[model samples]
Target: MIVLGIESSCDETGVAVVETGAQPVPVLRAHALHSQVEMHQAYGGVVPELASRDHIRRVLPLAGQVLADSGCALADVDVVAYTRGPGLAGALLVGAGVACALGAALAKPVLGVHHLEGHLLSPFLSQDPPEFPFVALLVSGGHTQLMQVDGVGRYTLLGETIDDAAGEAFDKSAKLLGLGYPGGPALSRLAEQGDPAAFKLPRPLLHSGDLDFSFAGLKTAVLTQVHKLGAELQARKADLAASTEAAIVEVLVKKSLAALDRSGLQRLVVAGGVGANRRLRAQLDAACAKRGVRVHYPELALCTDNGAMIALAAAMRLQAGVQQPSDSYAFDVKPRWPLDLTAIA
Candidate 1:
């Protein structure tokens, strides 16, 4: 089966095609992505209106590029898939509208996929795909969760953020340090030049004896330190960035290990944008290696929002017989869909 996926849930406009047959995993034939980071950089954050408009301009051309790159014609796709929720309502609409329109025009079935689930299943598209019954650390924007994934569309939520997610902690802290838009990567880059212990930062809920996470307190702590620096904030920015990153990474690593121990699952899959952090990867690699746990991640390019993961997820669901595409052309989107409840299986 050939699946075409579209993702416009946020600042990126992505389109991709995947091929699935007898293989356990779907093959990504080709994918194209365009990031709106540079455009949003001026505002120091994403503008929903701008993101939606950009998606409108980019989605179809990207679709054409992906199809051409994959050596497929418009008639080849078996299903049309698009991200349906947990993002800007406008952005989600752009992808959903385009996908359903395409499905209708071609008289093909359409499937609406959960954005986070796309991230969760992305590792399967990686060079090192994971097996079933593994722990998944989904650190996507605004979400930090640990889930036990039994199979495609079968997930058991272990824990999630009580307040701010780890990604928010990084971005907010970076903002406090005068870092521009897309603060996470900028903060991490600055961190490399400073000592992780340069300033004392709290690791919130690290000792809670549960998997639930809270980074709101950590952000407040960063704020406190920034205020204390006063005139020296400039010279000390990098140090603060390092200390903030260290605290966040330590909490993430320790909790991930704890989740592994509690779940008694030796395989770990980390997905979502924050999963691309070098520090987090290094810490996870070292910790999981010592515990003899196998760890997997999506290719760096797939770590952020993309169409490939969305299409791959839909193909996998269909392959596993857990879902069926809708023949109806009338479609609606969920801007706040939850991963655990949205699975069709």
Candidate 2:
């Protein structure tokens, strides 16, 4: 089966095609993505109205590109899938509308997928895909969560951020350092030249016993440090960045390990934009290796929001017999849907 997926959740417009049934995991045939980072850079963040408009202009062209790249025609798609929730309402609407319209025109079924589920299942598209019954750390700009994933659509929320997520801490902290838009990457790059122990930063909830996360206090701590440094901020920027990244990575690593120990799961999967962080990956790899635990990750290119994960998720859902696409063109999107609330088999 061929599934055409569309993703317009936030700042990126993505489209892709995936072929399933021949392998245990769906194969990504082709995918296209257009990032609005440059466009949003001027604003220091995403503008909901601008993002919705850009999605309108880019989604179809991206779809065409992926279809061409995959050597597939419109008629060959067995299902049309799109991210349906936990994002900007306008952005979600654009993809949902286009997906339903295409499904109606082509007379094919359409499926609405949870955005976080797309991230959670993304590692299945990796070259070294992980088996089911693993722990997943989903650290994205809008969310940070730990889940026990038994299989497609079967997820138990282990813990999540109560305030700002890890990504938010990174971005907001970078902003405190006068870094421009897309601050996380900028801060990370600068962190490479400094010492992780250069400054003290809090690791919230690291010893609370439970698995929940909190980064809001850490952001405040960064602000305090910025003010303390005052005129010396410029000279210590890289050190501060390194220290900030260290604090966040420490909490994430410890919590992830706690989740694994609690669940007795030997496999771990890390997904979402923050999962692309080099420090997080390196630490997780080293820690998991010591315990002889297998860790899985999507290719770096797939770590961000993309159509490939969306399409692969839809295919896996169908293969697992937990969901069925609808023939009816009428559709609605849930901007705050919970991943654990999705269909489970």
Candidate 3:
């Protein structure tokens, strides 16, 4: 089945074509993505209204690009898939509207996919894919969670952040250090040049013997350090960045290890934008290797929000006999949907 997937749940307008076969094999023909990062940079965060309007403008063009790149036609698409919720309501509606309209015109089925489920399953599209019943660490700008994935649509929440997500902490800490928006990548680059031992930051709730995470306190700690440094510590910015990265990575690694041990899952799949973090990757890779466990990550480009993952997820759901939304389906954006919802099955 050829599935056309649309993802406009956030600042990115992503469209992709995915082919799913009966042998549990999925192939990506082509995907096109347009990011609104530059537009949101000045605002220091995503403006929901602007993001939604841009999606309306970019979705069709991106979809056309994907079909052209894949040498496929609109009539060849077997199903239409789109993000249903857990994002900016307007942004979600933009994609939902386009997908529903296109599906209706084509007389094809439309599946509403969970945004986080796309992230969790993203690694399967990679070369070194993980099997089911593995541990998943999902760390994105808006969410942080560890889950035991038994199969498609089968997830058991293991742990999650109680306050700010790991990515948010990285961005907030970067802003305090005078770095611009989207701090995860920028702060990581600075960390490469500095000593990780320069400043010791706390690893909150790491050894709490529970699966819950807490990065809010760590962000506060960074703020306090910045206040203490005053103007004279500008020269030590790289060191601060490195130390902060190390602290965050340590907590994540420790907590993930705990989850793996508790679940007894030898394979770990890391997803979400923060899954692209260099230090976090290195730490998890090394830790998992030492414990005789395997680790998998989506291709670096797929770590963030994109249509390919959404498309792939939709294809899987269709293959699994998941119900399709009705023609009279109304747009419903879930700004706060839980990933463990059984209805998705």
Candidate 4:
């Protein structure tokens, strides 16, 4: 089966083609993406109007590029898969409209994929993939959660951030330190030269003995540290950055381990943008290795929002006999949606 996936859930406009049902697994024919990070940088955050307009401008062109790169015509696509919700309504509409229109034009099936589910299944797109019934730690800019995945589409939320997500904390702290928007990556790069022990930041709720997390207080701690050090801290940005990264990584690794222990799942999969953090991956790898458990991660480039994951997810859904919505089917975007609502099998 050939599935053409469209992802416009956020600032990224992505398109891909995947051929499924092969012996080893599905094969991704071609994948293309256009990121609006540069455009949104000036605003220090995503401006919904601009995001919507960009998606409108980019989706069709990206889709064309994917088809051309894959050496397939539009009619060759058997299914049109797209992110249906959990993002900006206007931004999502662009993809949804294009997907539905394409499906109608080609007389192909149209499937609405959940964005988070796309993230959860991302690891399978890599050379090494984890089996089912694993523990998933989803750490993104807007969400931080731990889930138990018994199989595709079968998820049970174990715990999540009660306050700001870990990525949000990174960006917020970086902004305070004079870093620009999307500060997570920039701050992480600076932390490499930082002395992890230079500053001691609070690990809020680290010992709460519960699965839930809280990073709001940790950000506040960074604020207080900045206020105290004033010009001195600004002069030593690298050290401060390193310390903050270390503290956040420690808390995340500890909590994820706790979740694994509680769930009794030997396999762990890290998803979402924060899963790309070098420190987090190292700590989790070490922790899982010591415990004789396995850890899985998406290809680093796939960690952020993209279309390949969505296509892979939709292909699996089709193979599982999940029905496609009717031509009259129409649903609006959801700024917030729980993953457990949809069952894969």
Candidate 5:
């Protein structure tokens, strides 16, 4: 089956095509993405109105690019899939409306996919895909969660952030250091130049004996340190950045391990934008290796929101017989859909 997927969840617009049933797992034929980082950079964050408008302009052209790259035609697409929720309502509507329009035009079935599920299942598209019954750490800009996954659509939320997520901590801390938009990557790059131990940062709830996470406190700590640095903040920005990244990574790595131990799962899959953090990956790799536990992550390119993950998720759900695409063109989006709530009914 040929599935075309569209993603316009937040600051990026993505499109892709996946071929299912030709192999044991679905294969990503081609995908295209357009990041609004540069556009949003001017505003230091995403503007919902601008994001929705950009998605309107970029989704179709990118979908065409994906089809051309995949050597497929629009008429050949059997199912049209789109990220249906947990994003900007306007952005979600753009993709949902466009997808339904396409499905109606082609008389093809359409499927609405949970955005987080796309991230959780993205690793399946990697070269060294993980098997079932794995623990997933879905860390992104807007969310941080630990889930017990038995299979497609089978997810139990082990824990999640109560306040600011890890990504938010990174971004907020970087902003305190006067870093530009998309502060996480900027701070990380600077962190490479200084010592992580130069200034201590808080690791919230590291010993609360629960799996839940809290990064708001840590962000506050960074702010306090920035104030303390005062005139010297510029001279020590790199050290502060390193220290901030260290605190976040330590909490994430330890919490992930805790989730694995609690669930008695031997495999771990880390997905989402924050999963692309080099520090998090290195620490998790080292820690998991020491424990003889297998850790999996999507290719760095796929770590961020993308159409490939959505298409792959839809195909997997279909293969598992957990979802039935609808022929009716009428559709609605859930901007706050929960992953656990997405369990097969």
Candidate 6:
């Protein structure tokens, strides 16, 4: 089966094609992505209107590119899949609309996939894919969660952020340091030059004894530190950036370990944009290695929002018999769909 996936969740427009064979796992044939980072950079964040308009302009060309790269024709696609929720509504609509229109035009079935599930199952597309019954740390844009996964569509929410998520903490803290848009990467780049021990930033709920996370207080702590730095902030900015990244990384690592211990799972899969963080990956590798646990992550390129994960997820769900594609052309999107809502045994 060939699955064509479209993703316009926020600042990126992505399209890809994947094929399933006798094996349960599907393989990515070709994928293409266009980042709106440079466009959003001017505004220090995404502007919903501009993002939607850009999606309108980019999705189809990218889809054509993926088809050409994969040596497949639009008529040859078996299923059309698109991210259907938990993103900017306008952005989601552009992808959903185009996907449904294609399905209607091709007379093929269409599937609406949960955006988070795309992130959750993305590692399956990697060279070293994870097996079932593992723990997943999904640290996407505004979401930070730990889930117990038994298989496709089977998930138990172990814990999640109560306030600001880890990504938010990174972005917000970087803003405090006068970093440009896409704060996480900027802060991490500067962090390479300084010491994490130069300043002490709070790690919220590191000892809460529960799996839930809280980073709002940590963001506040960063603000306080920035205010105190005053005129000296420029000279010591790198140190502060390093310290801030350290605090967020520590919280994420500790909580992840706690979730693994609580779930008694030996395998960990980290997904989402924050999962791309070098500090988080390095620390988790060391910590999990010490515990004799196996840790998995999507290829660095797939760590961000992309069409490959979306298409791979749809293929897996179809293979598992958990999701049924529709012949009806009518389509809608859920801007706030929860992952657990699709959880099934």
Query: In the order shown, what is each candidate's alpha-carbon RMSD?
Result: 0.9, 0.9, 1.3, 1.5, 0.8, 1.0
For model 6 the local lDDT of residue 238 reads 98
Among all windows of ten consecutive residues in candidate 5, which has the lowest summed lDDT?
336-345
What are the TM-scores, per candidate, against the unseen true structure? 0.98, 0.99, 0.97, 0.97, 0.99, 0.99
- lDDT for model 3 comes to 0.89
Q: Number of clashing pairs, model 5?
A: 1
Per-residue CA lDDT of model 5 for 162-254, tens digit only, reads 999988998999899999899999999999998999987888999999999999999999999999999999999999999999999999999
Q: Model 4, 1-345: lDDT tens per residue?
A: 889999999899989999986544578899999999999999998999999999999989899999999999998989999898788888888888888888888888788888989999989888898789899999998889999998877789998999999999999999988899889999999999889899989998899989898999989988888899887986788988989999889988998999889998889999999999999999999988999989999999899999998898898777766646446536466667788887842
TM-score of 2: 0.99
Candidate 2 regions with alpha-carbon error over 4 angstroms: none
Cα error of candidate 1 at position 34, Å = 0.8
Please identify model 5 stretches exceeding 4 Å from their true place.
Answer: none
Runs of candidate 1 exceeding 4 Å displacement:
none
How does candidate 1 score on lDDT?
Answer: 0.93
Cα lDDT of all candidates, in order? 0.93, 0.95, 0.89, 0.88, 0.94, 0.93
Task: Report the lDDT tens digits of candidate 1 across residue range 1-345.
Answer: 999999999999999999998788999999999999999999989999999999999999999999999999999999999998889999999999999999999999999999999999999999899999999999966899999898988988889999999889989889989898899999999999999999888888899989999999999999999899899999999899999999999998999999899989999999999999999999999999999999999999999999999999999999988899999988788888878886652
TM-score of 1: 0.98
Model 3, span 139-234: residue lDDT tens:
999999999998888888888999999999999999999889878889999999999999889999987989888999989988888998998568
lDDT of 3 at 86: 87
- Candidate 2: which pairs clash? 86-335
Q: Per-residue lDDT for 1-345 in model 6, tens only?
A: 999999999999999999999987998999999999999998988899999999999999999999999999998999999999889999999999999999999999999888889999998888889999999999976899999999999998999999998888889989999998899999999999999999988888999998889999988998999899899999999999999999989988999999999899999999999999999999999999999999999999999999999999899999999989999999888889879888541
Weakest lDDT window of 10 consecutive positions for candidate 1: 336-345
Better of 2 and 4 by lDDT: 2
The model with the greater TM-score, 4 or 6, is 6
